[model samples]
Target: MKLKLKPAIARRPRAMMGKLASAVRSKIEMEKIRRRGGPARIRKGPPEALLGLRRFVANPRQFGGFVSGPALAATITREIDPAAGPVLELGPGTGVFTRALLARGVPEHNLILVEADPMLAARLRLAFPQALVLACKAGSATPEMLGGLRPAAVVSGLPLLNFPGREVERILAAAFSFCTADAAIYQFTYGPKCPVREEIMARMELSAQRTARVWRNVPPASVYRITRD
Candidate 1:
């Protein structure tokens, strides 16, 4: 006579099979990534994009729920001058624009990346060892924090529209605090109008001009160049 198996024991084989299938799928995906030159090689694009999505889901207001595509980064940094001096990037989530900045001749050491997310900041530090990666909010950044380096241009990926009016001014004020007199801040927004409020701009004596638009991004975005009015 055969003995009857308990319910939990009977389910064990099915669960094991499921786990095995999952492991196989993971292995196949990893093999694909390896063929494409491994995770480190593709870190800049795919992995970071996925990381950004995860961050966005964790905090929609903070991350804006969208990653900046290469096209948008290219558009935002189109007019940047590599020789202008140190480039400050605000909210550089997966560093899409940072890569563009490097491609445009900006020295890796001359880049200042401000990321509030500690994980992203750590990754950035690993990705750009020479670059200064600060894990803090944009509004909280100060000249002292920058180590007395004045950025000639600020490439912002911050979702300014999602922030409060006062906070927006604070962030902008902080960004321009140590910048050169002629320095311009480049910001991108998904809205039809400028992300920075008119009153705030007037109060800060700043003027914004729509420089470019990239429709290839997840949500079409407009780049604005903000300068002293």
Candidate 2:
């Protein structure tokens, strides 16, 4: 008998067809990129020098600035517990650390990225649309910047050593004030030792210990965990 067609059975085939279409589309896109050059070929540089006059005006010692090595970036983000609340990333240059943080299970919505360079900030906003990206000086950021949100961890890519002594102190204080009591600050530096000098550490009522050394990175670098005693 010409009997019964169920609605569920009709829907199953359509759903399966949709899945097949998606898989085919993804494969085509991958092949196109591979045939070109690679994913890197599709990427573009910032529209302008993000760091601005700071790039030419500051001396090497005064800048203490280095984009974080990929290995070191992985280490810092790995230490972040996924269960922790939102994370605050300072001076997220070109979003190296920002990408690592996402790979480490921190949701994009839970990240607040503060970048001082206008060009870099714009790039970050485009690259990480899910993150709460802001173009502002780290030292000048207030708790309200996050819309009254409190971060569980602060991961900074800023060149702390290059900052003047007072500026460094102010940045640290502002970071600590916004962070939860148990929150930790992850910072990487190529300096001889921790970026936060002994005096600044004491004044901030914080202490830092080296967490990892990434020798494969350019000029090498170390990750430090600063926390309140």
Candidate 3:
């Protein structure tokens, strides 16, 4: 029987290939920045866009795009209390949001970054040696992954809309387990509604509020503060 190409699948490869090409270019730029000795500082020229593209090529469903610009990242991390306790960052791709948390007075040692990409995790270790970096998926986050530190806040960059309902629930539950009772989960989404599923939010007794909308980002995005009280 002759097979017909599914439109979505057929278009995916070309889009992914183009993204991979851009991602490669972005990696080259990162290597140069790494050599210059300040990996945390964001730079112009195919930086966030390239990293986002590369990640999109690797896992389109799991990432919307990189933290577009510092405006959004800084906004997402605004509520984290640097001295209150440790902070857990999910999918700290290219460390843009990670840098923002650091800029906001969070201690390097108190920040724990969980990144699914081994390559990115390796670079994060070199960039922020004091910060703990775990190379693992969001679905597998646990207190053990954080070396037993209870996080005061959770700042996530994981693409929730790309995940199935179960996976999203699992990731959220795991991250929240480490947070204090009144802590917040900061997330950014490009969609019209919150990235988190409404049912999951209701089930988890979480409340979400859009704190900021940043048009300066590559594609405009809004930051949501998710809290469990």
Best by TM-score: 1
TM-score of each: 0.83, 0.74, 0.78
CA-lDDT, candidates in order = 0.89, 0.79, 0.84
Of the two candidates 1 and 3, the one with more favorable TM-score, higher being better, is 1
Per-residue lDDT of 80-129 in model 1, one digit per residue for the tens? Answer: 89988999999988778889999989999999999999988888887888
Model 3: what TM-score? 0.78
The residue pairs that clash in candidate 1, if any, are none
Model 2: per-residue Cα lDDT over 101-175, one tens digit each: 888999989999987777667767776777898888889999888897788999988888778889888888888
What would the C-alpha RMSD of candidate 3 be, to one decimal place? 10.9
lDDT of 3: 0.84
- Could you arrange the candidates by lDDT from highest to lowest? 1, 3, 2
lDDT of 1: 0.89
Judging by lDDT, tell me the better candidate of 2 and 3. Answer: 3
Stretches of candidate 1 off by over 4 Å are 1-42
